[model samples]
Target: MLQQSSAALASVFDRASEDYDRTGAAFFTPLGRRLVEKARVEPGSSVLDVGCGSGACLFPAALATGPKGRVVGIDLAPGMVGRARRAAESQRLGNVSVQLMDAFRPEFHGARFDFVLSSMVLVWLPDSAEVLERYRPLLNPGGRFAFCNPRLTGQDGIPFVPEIFGTVMESVGVHPKTFFEDLDNGWLGAPDAALLKAGYTGIEVCDETYSLELLSGEDWVRWSWSHGFRSFWERVPQARLGELEKEVAEGIDLLRDSDGVIRIPGTVRYVSAST
Candidate 1:
C-alpha cells in the first residue's frame, strides 16, 4: 500500500514538474526562500533538501552556502529531479546536485549534512515523527532539521481557498476530511512533542502568513493543479473536471476584488529542531 501510494504521488509530481512553479504563481519560490532564510544556512555548510521540487529550497540554500558548500536535493519524481538538475546546470550552480530518491529512504551516509531541510512537504507524510527520527542520522552533530506545513486551527481548519474546493469535492462525493486526517490527528497543529520524541532539541516554531493573488478563477485552477493540491484534484473524476472548474470559478468569483483579482490568505508554520 505504501509503495502504491508513493508511486501515485511520484506520478502526479512527474506530470506537474514541467510547469510546477512556472505558472506565474508567486507561491513556492518565495516560501522556499523564506524557509532557507529561517533555517539560517551558513557559508560552507552542507545541506540536504528533501522533496526539492524544481530547486525551490535547493537553489536558495545553494546561494546561502556559497560556491564552497554543497547542497544535494532529492525527490521521488524523475521529472522533478531532471528539472532541478537542468535548472542548476543552467544557473551554473556547481554547488548543487539533484537526485531521484524517496524522502523517507534517503541513501546518504550517516551525518552527511550540516542541515536537512524540507519546505511544505512534511505534513503529507503518514508518520512525520518517524520520518524525523529516520532523518536525524543524516545530520551531523548539532545539525538542524527545518520544515514547514500549512497552519490549521483544528481538524476542520481547511484554508479558505481549499475549503472552496473541498465543497466542490463533496459535490463529487469526496470528503475534504480525506485530505486532512493526518493533520487533524495533531502532527501539524502541535509538532513539538513529535520532535522531542524523535530525539531533537532546541525546537522553534514560527508562524507566517502570505497572500496569494490570482488574476481570475482560471488562474486559481491552474495554480491548484501545479502543486500538492494536485493530489486533491486527482481524486476528482475526469468527467467531472469541467463541472469542478465551473463550480470552483463561481466559488472563487465570490472573493474577487474590484480589480478582478482574487486574494487568498494562507498561513505557514515553520518548525526547526537541532540534533
Candidate 2:
C-alpha cells in the first residue's frame, strides 16, 4: 500500500512539474516560506525541507540559513527535484541541494537537522502521527519541526471543479475518485495530540484564511489542472479529458462576480513543535 501510494504521488507531481512552480507560486510557495520563517531559522543552522516542491521554501530557507548553513530539500518526485535543483543553480545557491527522496522514510547517514519544514504535505498522508514520529529522530535535541496544511473549514475553498467534475463523471457511469475522498482518507486535522504522542513539545498550531483573486474561470482551471486536478485527469480517459476540462471550466465560470474576478477563499493551519 505504501509503495502504491508513493508511486501515485510521484506520478501526480511528476506530471504536474511543468506548471507546479507557477501555479504554486501564488500560494504554496508563500505558505512554505511562512513555515520556515516560523521555525525561527538562524544563520549556520541545518535545515531540511520535506516535500519541497520547486524550491519554494528551499531557496528562502537557504537564504535564511546564510552561506555558512546547509539546506537540504527532498521530494518523492524526481521531476520536482530537477526543477528545484535548476532554480537553485540559476540563483547560484551553493548552500542548497535538492534530492529525490521519500519524506515518509527519509534517510541520511549520521546527519541531523536543526529544523525540518514541510507545507501542504501532511494532508496527503494516511497517518500524520506516524510520519511525525519518523521525522522526530532526524532532528537534533530541541530541534523544531514546522509544517502547514489546509484547514478545510466552511466551504472547502473555491473553483469547486473537482467535486463538479466527479459528479459529471459519475453521471456518465464513469466513476473517478474525487479530491475530497483523498482528504477524507488522509490526515484531516491539526494533529496537536498526535504531535504530543510523537514526543514533541511546545506545539503551536495557528489557523489563518487567505483570499485569492482569479481573473476568470480559465485561470482557475489552469491552476487546478496543474495542481489538484492532476490525479483526476490521469484517471479520466484520454479522449474524455477535453470534455472534462470544458465542463469544469464552465462550472468555475459561474463563480465569477459581476466584476469578473473570482474570490477564492482558502484556510490553512500552521503546526510547529520542538522535538
Candidate 3:
C-alpha cells in the first residue's frame, strides 16, 4: 500500500547486491548504525535481521551478538540473501548465516529470536501491520523488535530545470506521483495502535532525522533521483530525466556552502518494542 514501484526498486537493489555490501563504510552509514543500535544486541543473543539487504544489517548484528551468539539475516529477494551469504563466507564469519525468506511470512519454528531488526523495509511493504503480526510469533518472551522507516515531510523539494533526468523524462513525458506524506494506512502506522494491540511491551518510539552533507552536484542529483523524485521521474518523459537531473543539481549547488557541501534534511520514525 505504500510503495508504488516496489518490484522495480527490489530489482534495482538486487542488481546492486555486490556493490551494496562491498561499500562497507558507506553501507553502514551513521543512519544504519543508529537503526542497528536499537536492537540492543548482547553477547550470546540470537538475532534475526529481516530485510537484511546485502549485509548492512547482518554484519552489524553479527558484531553485536559475538562469537558466543549468532545472527541470521534474511531477505525476500534471493539475490540479496545470496550476496549476504557470500559476504559472510568470505569474511569467514562462521557464526552468521543468511536465508531467502519473506518479510511478511517468515518461515521459522517457534519463538527463536532475542532481537529482530528491520530498516526501511517495513515502510515499503503493502501489509506492514500483518508483517508485524507475523514477526510477533517469532520473538521469544523478553525478545525485542526494532525498526526504522522514513517519515514523510511535506516540504517543497528541488525545482526541476534542465538535467539528465529532466531531459529524459521530458522527452518521454512521464510523471510519477511523488509527495512526502505521513506514514499511515498500514504501511507506516495503524489507528489500532498496532504495536500495542499486538501485545508488545516496553514500546519505545522515537523520531530520528538525518541531515545529509551533499559533497557534489552529482551526489545531490543521484540521491534525489534515487529517493523522493524517483517515482516522479519514472512518470516523466524519458527525455526530461536529464533535464530534471540538471535542475536538481542546480538547486543543490545553490544550497552549497563555500566548502561546496550542500546539506539536506530528512526524517524517520524509529521504534523498539519488546514481548
Candidate 4:
C-alpha cells in the first residue's frame, strides 16, 4: 500500500514538474522558506529535506548552510529531483545534492544529519507517528526536525475550491476517492503530542491562516491541477475530466472578489522538535 501510494503521488507530481513552481510558487514557496526559517539552520550544519519539490526549501537551506555545510534533497518524483539538480548546478551550489527517494523509507543509516525538514509532505503518509519515529533515529543528538503542512480548520474543513470540486464530482455521480475524504492519510492534528510520543523534545506547534490570489478563476484551476488538489481530480474518469474541470472553474469564479482576483483560503500547521 505504501509503495502504491508513493507511486500515485509521484505520477501526479511528475506530470506537474515543468510548471509546478510557476503555477503554485505564490503559495508554496513562502511556506517552504518559513519551514527553513523555523528549523533555525546554521552554517556548517548537515540538513536533510524530504519532499523538497523544485528546491524551494532546499535552495534556501543550501544558502543558509553556505560553503561549509551540506544540504541534501530527496523527492519521490524524478522530474522534481531533476529540476532541483538543474537549479543547483545553474546556481553553482556545490554544497547541495538531490536524489529521487521515498520519504517514508529513506535510504540512509545512522544519525547523519543535524536537521531534518519537510513541507506539506507528512500529510500524505499512511502513518504519521510511525514515519516520525523513523525520522527520529536519523537525527543526531540534539538535532532538530521541522515541518509545515496544512491542518484542516473548524467544521467547514478544506479550502473553498477543493470542497466545491469534491461536491461537483459527487454530484456527477463519479464518487471518486479523494485524499481529503480520508483525513488520516491526508491531514494532521496537534502534532506536539505525537512528537513527544516519537521521542522528540522541545516541541513547538503553531497554526496560521493564509490567503492566495490567482490572476483569475482559470488560474486557480490551473494552480489546483498542479498542486495539493491534483490527486483528487486525477481520480475522475478521463471521459468526465473535461466536464469536472469546467464545473470547478465556474464554481470558483462565483466566489471571486470585486477586484476580479480569486481568493483561495488556507491554513498551515508548523511543527518543530528536537531529538
Superposition error at 1 for model 1 (Å):
13
**lDDT by residue (tens digit), candidate 1, 75-143:** 999999999999999999999998899887778865489999999777656566688888998989999
Candidate 3 shows a clash count of 43
Q: What is the TM-score of each predicted model, taking all chains together?
A: 0.94, 0.88, 0.81, 0.91
Give one digit per residue, the lDDT tens place, for model 4 in 202-259: 9888888778777666777788777546765666788888887888878778887888
lDDT of each: 0.84, 0.76, 0.66, 0.79
Model 2 regions more than 4 Å off? 1-4, 23-25, 154-166, 169-187
C-alpha RMSD (angstroms) for model 3: 4.3
Kindly report which residue stretches of model 4 are placed more than 4 angstroms away from their true locations once superposed: 1-4, 160-162, 173-178, 184-187
Cα error, residue 218 of model 2, in Å, equals 2.0
- lDDT score, residue 184, model 2? 41
Q: Write the per-residue lDDT of candidate 3 for residues 182-231, one digit (tens) a residue.
A: 34334454322778777888888877666666666667555544433445
Q: Which candidate gets the maximum TM-score versus the true structure?
A: 1
lDDT of the structure predicted as candidate 3: 0.66
By lDDT, the better pick of 2 and 3 is 2
Colliding pairs, model 2: none
